[model samples]
Target chain A: MINLLFLPLVIPLATAVACLLAWKNQGLQRIISLIGSFLLLIAAAVLLVTVQQDGVLSVQGGGWAAPFGITLVADLFSALMVCVAAGMGLVVAIYSLADTEAEYERLGYHPLMQVLMLGVCGSFLTGDIFNLYVWFETMLIASFVLLAMGGKRAQMEGAIKYVVLNLIASALFLAAVGILYGVAGTLNMADLARMLRESESSGPIPVIAILFFIAFGIKAAVFPLFFWLPASYHTAPMAVTTIFSALLTKVGVYALIRIFTLVFFAELAAWQPYVLAIAGLTMVIGVLGAVAQDEMRRLLSFHIVSQIGYLIMGLGLLTPLALGGAIYFMVHVIAAKSALFLATGMVLRLTGTTELKKLGGLYRHQPLLAGLFLVAALALAGIPPLSGFWAKLALIWSGLESGNHYLVVAVALLVSLLTLFSMTKIWAAAFWKGAVVNGATDTPLPLSRRVYWQMAVPTALLTATTVLIGLWPEPLYALCMDAARQLLVPDAYIFAVLGVQP
Target chain B: MSSIILSTTIRLLLPLLLLFSVFLLLRGHNEPGGGFVGGLVAAAAISLYALAEGVAAAHRILIVNPRQLIASGLLVALSSGVIPLMTGRPFQSGLWLPYSLPVLGHVGTPLLFDLGVYLLVAGMALLIVLSLMEEE
Candidate 1:
C-alpha cells in the first residue's frame, strides 16, 4: 500500500519521458502528457484515500529501514497537497492544449510541464530532507526553462533574476542541510524531528531554523524576499505563468509549514512573534505592490506574495484551528488564483495585451468571460459565498480566539479591503471601461467559439470548484482539520515513518 | 579549439573515457563510482568528441538526440521503482533476481536505478554542452 505513494511521482516522470519521445509529433505529445496527468490525478486521489484509511503511510527506499536509507512518507497534509497539485496539473494540461503555442510544443513544453509536476509530487512525498532539496532543484530547472522557452527579451530578463536569486536560496538551503545533518546525523525529516526533541541543548537549532526560514522564505516570496516574483511571473506564457503562480511559492510555503510543524514545533515559542510580524508586513506590502501594478499578471503575481502571508500567519498563530485555516486558505488560493490567471490569459488572447490601459470592454464584448473573472476576483477579495470568505473568516476567528494579537486581525481585515480594492481596479480598467480607440492594434478579433471554449472550459471549471468549495466548506474543512491535527502533533507521522516512539 | 595535437589526443582518449565510465557505473552500487560520477565521465567523453570533431560530427555519432537519452533514462529509472511494486513491496524497494548473473552477479533494481541515473546525467550534460557548442 505504501508503494502507492510512488505512483504520483512515477507517472508524471514516465509521462514526461513519453512526451519527450513524441516531441516531433505535437499532437502525440499532448495526448501522452494528458494521459500522464490524468493518471497522476488518480494516483494522488488514491494516495489521499489510503492515507485517510490506513493512517500515515511511509515507504522505505531500496528496502532500507528508516533514518538509514531514503524514505517517502505521507500524512494527511502531504496527501491533500499532492492531490491538489495533481488537480492543478490536470487543469493546466487541459488549458495548455489551447494556450501553448506550436513553437513551444516543438521545443518540448509538454515534457517540461510533466517534469515540473514530477518535482512537485516528489517534493510533497519525500520524507528525506535532502531528497526534498533535489526535488526543489528539479522544479527550479524545469521552471527556468519554461520561463525562457520563448526567448523573449522580457522572459530572459525575468528568468535570469529568477534563477540567480533561487540559486542563492539553494546554496543557503544546502549549507543549512549540511549543518542540520551534522547535528542530527540524519537527513530524514522524521529522524531529525525525533532527534531534535531528544537533544538536551537546542541552542543551535534556532539558528538552523533561521537558515531554513531564509531559504524557504525566499522561495515562498514572503515580504522582503519577494522581489523576483513580480519581475518574472508576468513574462512567461499563459500556461507556464499559471502553473508557476499556482505551484511554485506554494511549495515553499508547504516546506515552511512542514518544517515548522514537524521539526521545529517545540521551538515555536521563540519564533512565533517574529513570524506574526513578518506575516503582517508581507500582506500589507504585497497588496500595496499589487495596487501599484498596471499589468494584469504582475498584479496577480504580487497578490501571490500577499496570500502567502496569510498561510504563514496561520503558522504564526500556533494553534490547530489557525493551522487548519491556513490549510483551507491554501486550497482556496490555488483554485482561485489559477482561475484568475487563466481568465486574464483569455482576456489577453482577445485583446492581444494584458496591459490595463490597452484592455477594456471585456464586459461589453464577452459577458461570460467577464463573469468568470468576477467569480475569481470576488473570491480573491473575500466576498461572502466565495472560497476566500471562509478562509479569511477562519483565520480572523482563530486570531481572535488566540487573543494575543488584535493587530493581526486588524491587518488581515484591512488587507481584505485592499484586496477588494485591487480587484475592483482590474475590473474597472479591464472590464467596465470601453476599449480605448487606439489605431490598428486596438481591436483584435476574438478567437473562434471552439477555441474560446478550449480556454473558457478550464477557467470555468476552476471558478466552479472555487464557488462549490465556498458554498460547501464542510468536506474541505474536515480534511484541513485532520491535516492540521497531524501537523500540530506529528507523533503519527514519526511513528508511521520510523515505526517507533519518539 | 583548433589545435591539431589537442584534437588528436581527445580523439584517441574518447573510447577509453567511455569505457571507464561504464566500468564506474557497474561498480557504483557499493563503491564511490556511482551513476552520477559515471555520467559525468561519459559526458566528458562526449564533450571531448565535440571539441575534437566539432558539434556536427559529435551529433552524427550520437545518432539519437540527448533528449531521447534523458527521457529513456527517466523511464528506465521509473520502471525500476515500479518493478518492486509487482511483488507487493513498497515503492523503490530493491528487487533482485533469484540467481546470480555471470559477470555483474545478482542483478537487482538498485543497479538498474543507477544505470538510469547514469544515462540521465550524461544526456543532460551533453544536451546542455552540445547546444551551447552548436550556438557558438
Candidate 2:
C-alpha cells in the first residue's frame, strides 16, 4: 500500500544502474531498461489506485520523524505527475529503442536516459522545498547530458547556451533557498506553509518569488525566458529533443504550481494578474513562432512554449476548476506533445529530413503513422472527442465561472483556433503533399517495421488515453478534484508535517 | 582533456569519501546532516572521480550505474511510515523507540527518510555533473 510511492523512484533508479553496469551488452541493457519502464508504468497505476483509496501518502526519512528529516509525498497532484512522467518515459523509451540504439551503445546514452527518468519522477514526488531544488537540478543535469548527448557540432553550440541559462537558474535557486531558510527557518514545504500563514514575507518574498519564477520560467521556456529552448532543442537527436520537448520544460511549470500554491499563496492576487498576462503573451507568441518556422521539430518546440501559456493561464485563473483544468491539460499535453515528437521521430526516420520543404506527402506512404500523427496533432489543437477538448472546455468554463471573462473566454477561444492553425501547418508541411523522395540522402531511411510497430503503439496508446478521458472523464476529474482539494485545504498536509491539531 | 594526474587522485579518494558520505547519510536523522548533505557528499565522491577518470570511465564505475540506489533507499524510508498508516495513524507519523544501544537505537522513519534523500541527492547531482562533463 504505502510501497507504491517509492516504486516510481525505485524501479527507474535500479534499472538505470543495472543498465550502466551491464551497458557493454546493448541488448541486455535495452531489455532491462524497457522492463524497468514497464514496471514503473505499473507502479504509477498502483499509485493512482492508492491515492484513490487514500488521500495523500507521506514517507518520513531514516524512520526518524518529519519537520526534521526530508520526505517524499504523493498527493493526488504528485501522483498524477508520477503517472504522466512514467507513462511518457515508457512511451519515449519504446520510441527511442529503434530511434537511438546506435547512440545507446557507442556512448553514455542508456545511463543518461535512466538518470533523466529518475530526476523527472523524483521532482514529481518529493515533499520538501529544498528537495524540489535538488530534483530540479537533477533533471537539469540529465537534460544537459541529453542535450549534449550526441556531441555534434550544433549540439555543442546549443549546449553552451542551455548550460549558461540553467546554471544561472540553478544559482538563483540556491540563493533563493538561502533566503527561504533565513526567513522561514525550515526547508520542509508543509512546515514553511504553516509558518508562512502566520506572516507574509515583506522584504524578500517578492524577490524570492521572482527569482524562483525566473528560474522556472527559463526551464518552462516562458515568453521572454524561452529563447534557450528553440535554440538547443533542434540540435539534440530527434529522440532526445522529443522527450525534452514533451517533459523537461513542464518540470519548471510543475514547480511553479507547487510553490505558488503552497508557500506563495499570500501573494496570489498580485501575482495572478501578472501570471495571466504572461500566459496570454506566451500562447500568442508561441503560436506565432510556430507559424513562422520551416522545420517540423523547431516549430513544434515553439508551440510547446505557447501551450504552456495555456497551463499558466489556468493557474492565473486560480479557481479550483481552473487549477484542475491546468492539471488535466498537463496530462493531455504530455500525451499529445510527446506523441507528436515521437511521430516526428518516425517521420525523420523515414523521410530523412524534418524540413517542411524537403519532405511532404508522408500520409499516402505511411498511412498508420500518418493517422497517429493526425490524432496527436488534433488533440494538441483541442479538437473534439479528444482529451484536449475537454481540458480546454474546463479551463474556459472555469474562466467564465470565475468572471475573468475576457482573459479566460476571449483568449481561450483565440488560442484554440491558433493551436489549430499551428498544428495544421505541420499537417500541411509534413504529411499533406505527395512524397518527395529527396536526393539529399545520408545514413538512408529505415524500413524496419510498420512505423506503428515500435513507434505507433506508444503514440496511439497516449492518443487513446486522450480520447478515453475526453469521452468519460469522471474518474480523472474526480482524482484531480481530490488532488486540488488536498492542495487548497492545507490542513492535512500541515498535519502530515507537524502532527499538531490546531 | 582526460588528465591522468587528476584520475589518480580521484581513484585514491573515491572509496574513502563515499564511505564518509554513507556515514553522513546514516547519522543525518538526529544530527546536522541528512539526505541533501549526504547526497552532495556522495555526489562529490562520484564527480571527483569523473574529473580524474575521464567522463566515460567515471560514468562506468560510479554514477552511471548507481543512481537507482536512491529508490531503494526511498522504499526503505517510505516503508517505515506504513507501519503507522496501517494502524490508522496519520501518514508518516513517527513510531519512535528510545533504544538501549546509544544513538543508533533512535531508528525511525526520519532516519530512513534522510537515507532516501541522501541517495537521491547523491545520484541526482552525479547525474547532472557527469552528463555535463561528458559533453565537455
Candidate 3:
C-alpha cells in the first residue's frame, strides 16, 4: 500500500528520463508516456480503494520517524486527487498522440510532461510543506519547457512572464516553508496542526499562516494575483493551454485546501471571513474579465479564474458540506474545464482560428463538437443534474446551515448569473449563429478520424463521470468526508509519521 | 588586435569562474554559500563566453537548452524529497546515508536537493542571459 503511494509520482519521473534518453525516438517516447500514464491510472484506482478501506495511509522514509524525516501520506483527498491527475494525464496523452513528438527532440515536451505530472501528483499527496515546495518547483520547471517548446515570438514573450512570475511564486513558497519550518520546527502537516492546536495564541502562527495563504493565493489565481494566467495561457499551443487550464492553478487551490484545513484551522474565526470577502470579489471580477474577452481561449482562461472563486468560497465557509461541495465542484470543474479546452482545440484544429468573430455557426456544421462543448459549458455554469450543480447545492446548503445564508446565496446567485452570461456568449458567437463560418466558408474539410478519436474519448469519459457523480454522489461524498476527517484529525497523520499508533 | 585580447581573456577566465561556482555550491549549506549564489556565478561564466562568441555558437557549446535544463533540474530536485514515498514515509522525511567514509559522516536528501537547486538556478539564470544575448 505504501509503495503504491509513490507509483503515480515515480513512474512518470522514470518515464521522463527514458523519454529524454530516447529523445530521437518519437514513437518510443509516445509509447512510454502512454504506458506510463496508464500504469499511474491503475495506481490511482488502487489508492482510491485502499483509502476507502483504511481512511489515511502514511509512509516514513529511511526508516526514520515523523518530524525527523520526510513523509508521504495519503488520505482520501490525496488519493482522489491522484486519480484526477492521472486520469487527466491519460486523456492528455491521448490528445498528444495525434501530433508528432519526434520533430522537437531538443525541447523534450514528452519528457517534461511526465515530470510535470510527477510534481502535480506529489504535491497532491505530500504531507510535508517543504516537500510540497520542492514539488511546486519541480512542476514549474516542466512548465517552462511545455510553455516555451514552440519558441515562437508569442511563446518566448509569454514564457518570459510565465517563468518570472512562477519563479517569484516559488521563492515565496520557499519563504513560507522557511518561516513555517523556523516557527514550527517541523515540516510535517499533522505535527504542525497538533502544535497549532496546542498553541492558539502563538504570535508567529498567524504570520506563517498568512504567508502560506498568499503563496497559495498566487498559485490559485485569486482575483488580484491572477493577471499572469490570462496573459500567458492564451499564448501557448492549444493542447498545452488545455492541459494547463485543467491542472496548473487547480494545484494551487488544492494546496490552499490542504494547508487551511490542516495547519491553519485556528485562523478560521478571525481570518476566514476575510477570505469569504475575497472569494466573493474574485468570482465577480473573474467573470467580468471573461465577459470582456473576445478570444475563445482567453475567455475560457478568465472563466477558470472565476470558477476558482467558487472553490475558494467553499473553503471560506469552512463547513463540511461546503468543503464537500468544494471537492465535488473541483472534480466537476476539472472535467468541464479540460473538456471545454479540448473542444476548443478541436475547433481550432478544424478552423485554424480561435477568435469568436472569425467563428460562427459551428453548432450547425459540427453538431457533435457543439454538443460536447455545450455539455461542458452548461456543467460549468452549474446547471442541475450536472456535476457543477451538485457541488453548488452542497456549498449553498452548508453555508446556509452555518448562518452564512445571505453570503452564500448572494454570491451563488451573482456568480452563476455571470457564469451563464459568459457561457451564453460562447453559445451565441461560436454555436448559435446562422451558418457563416469565416475560415472554411466554401469547403470545410471533414473532421479526421484521428482528431475526433483523440478528443471524443476523453470528452465522453469526463462528461459521463460528471453526470454519474452528480446523479449518484454517494461514493465521492463518502470519500470526501473521509478525506476531510483525516485532514481534521491530525493525530492519524502524526502517529503515522512518528511510527507510533497513538 | 583588441578583439583578440578580449576573446583570449574570455578563454582564460571562463574555467576559473566555473571552478569558483563549484566552490560556492560545495560550501553552501553550512558556510554562507548555496545554490542560488553558485548558479549566478556559473551564469556569469557562461555570459562571458557568450559575449565573445555569437549566441548561436555559444548555444552549441552549451549543448542543452537552458529551459530544458531548468525543467530537468527541477525534476531532480523535486525527486529528492519525494523518494521517501516509496519507502513508506512522508514525502521528504530525511533519508540519510550517514556517510562516514573518511570523515564525511553527515549526508541527507537536503544536500542532493541543494544540488538540484544549484542546477535549476544555473539553468534558469543562464536562460535569461542567453535569451538577452540572442536578442542582441
Q: Which candidate is the best by lDDT?
A: 1
How close is each model in CA RMSD to the real structure?
Answer: 2.1, 6.1, 4.9
Evaluate model 2 with DockQ and give the value: 0.11
Residue-wise C-alpha lDDT for candidate 2, range A165-198, written one tens digit per residue: 8898888888888888887788888888887788
Best TM-score goes to which candidate?
1
- Residue A132 of model 1 has an lDDT of 93
Badly placed stretches (over 4 Å) of model 2 are A437-446, A450-452, B1-136
Writing each residue's lDDT as its tens digit, candidate 1 over B15-90 gives 8999999999999888789888999999999888888889998988889899888888887888888888888887
Every model's DockQ, to 2 decimals?
Answer: 0.71, 0.11, 0.21
- What tier of docking accuracy does candidate 1 attain? medium
TM-score of chain A of each: 0.98, 0.96, 0.96
Q: What is the lDDT of residue A420 in candidate 2?
A: 92
TM-score of each model's chain B: 0.94, 0.79, 0.87
TM-score: model 3 vs. ground truth: 0.82
lDDT of 1 by residue, A340-457 (tens): 9999999888888888887777787789989999999999999999999999988999999988889988999999999999999998889988777782126767698788898999
The 10-residue segment with the lowest total lDDT in model 1 chain A: A437-446
Q: Best DockQ goes to which candidate?
A: 1
CA displacement after TM-score superposition, residue A222 of candidate 2 (Å): 1.4
